[model samples]
Target: MSLRLFNPRVISRAALPSTSRTFIPSIRRLQDSSSDAPANPKLESIVDQIASLNLVEAADLAQLLKTKLNIQDVAMPAVAAAPAASADAAAEAEEDKPKEKTIFSVKLESIDQTAKAKVIKEVKALNPTMNLVEAKKFVESAPQVLKEGLTKEDAEKLQKALEAAGAKIVLE
Candidate 1:
């Protein structure tokens, strides 16, 4: 059966026999590749020349050359191991430290009186147990519609009527 890249499943269902392809490299291919290594003739000659320099000259050159070249730098894998191990050990050590807990308490009281009672009832209906000053403020700030929703003249009459009965009204 023919191979169709997009429909490989159809080929499998067709039950075609499989073929074994063997791969083998010739002698010419084996002889073609060479190892890669750098040959720095200039650096080698400089090292040889430095070794021949007198002690005083070498000391002066060494002082001048601080950090200019590093011949035996440590590999990163070796350098990184110590810090990682120490960090792990530090985390383990910190878990053993004792922790402290804190708690608190509060007390509250309610007061009752007459002129304040009406105000308290209104305030409590809107929001429970409002402070005395807040209740007074609420009464003072209440709207006209809320207070009575009457004309100026009618409001005056109502106020007079309420006063006659020893009552006070606050408008929204």
Candidate 2:
């Protein structure tokens, strides 16, 4: 079992090469020693000072700089950061987007007999120009549309109001 642990293929102690290899400096070190040297000490100090500032102080400094430089806020154009295939897939997904309902019609399907009076009052309240008798007649009519071509918000509001008054309403 101990002999199995020591493999003959594995060389435990390898002899070093007779000749030493020459050291070659990296391209970055070579470039650093050339014309492209370190940044200006004053600029680096300013950057270090800015980095030390807290969030609010940094924001105030940024605002001051913007005002001093008369810099106007300009929105940057949106760039698609996805790969070509992903961008094509995204465009196809956008093209396959479902149509959203904007305008809706509020229909009064029916009103409970017991809540007829309450429903009538709500209908009259909904339309202030309608008299009580007209509103009552409107409420009596079954499966009649109350309001048409209304926005989603208005339709939802009317639906809630009528439902609360014990009326069956549908928004189409």
Name the 10 consecutive residues with the lowest summed lDDT in model 2. Answer: 15-24
lDDT of 2 by residue, 121-152 (tens): 99999889999999988888778888899999
> Against the unseen true structure, what C-alpha lDDT does each candidate score?
0.50, 0.84
| TM value for model 2 | 0.46
Candidate 1 per-residue lDDT over residues 9-122, each given as its tens digit: 445423544331111233334554343444478987998999899999998787667666654444555356589887888788888776432221111112223444554445
Model 1: residue 62 alpha-carbon error in angstroms: 9.7
TM-score of 1: 0.19
Top candidate (lDDT) = 2
Q: Candidate 1 overall Cα lDDT vs. reference? A: 0.50
Q: What's the CA error at residue 19 for candidate 1, in Å?
A: 43
Worst 10 residues of 1 by lDDT: 101-110
lDDT against true structure, model 2: 0.84
TM-score of each: 0.19, 0.46
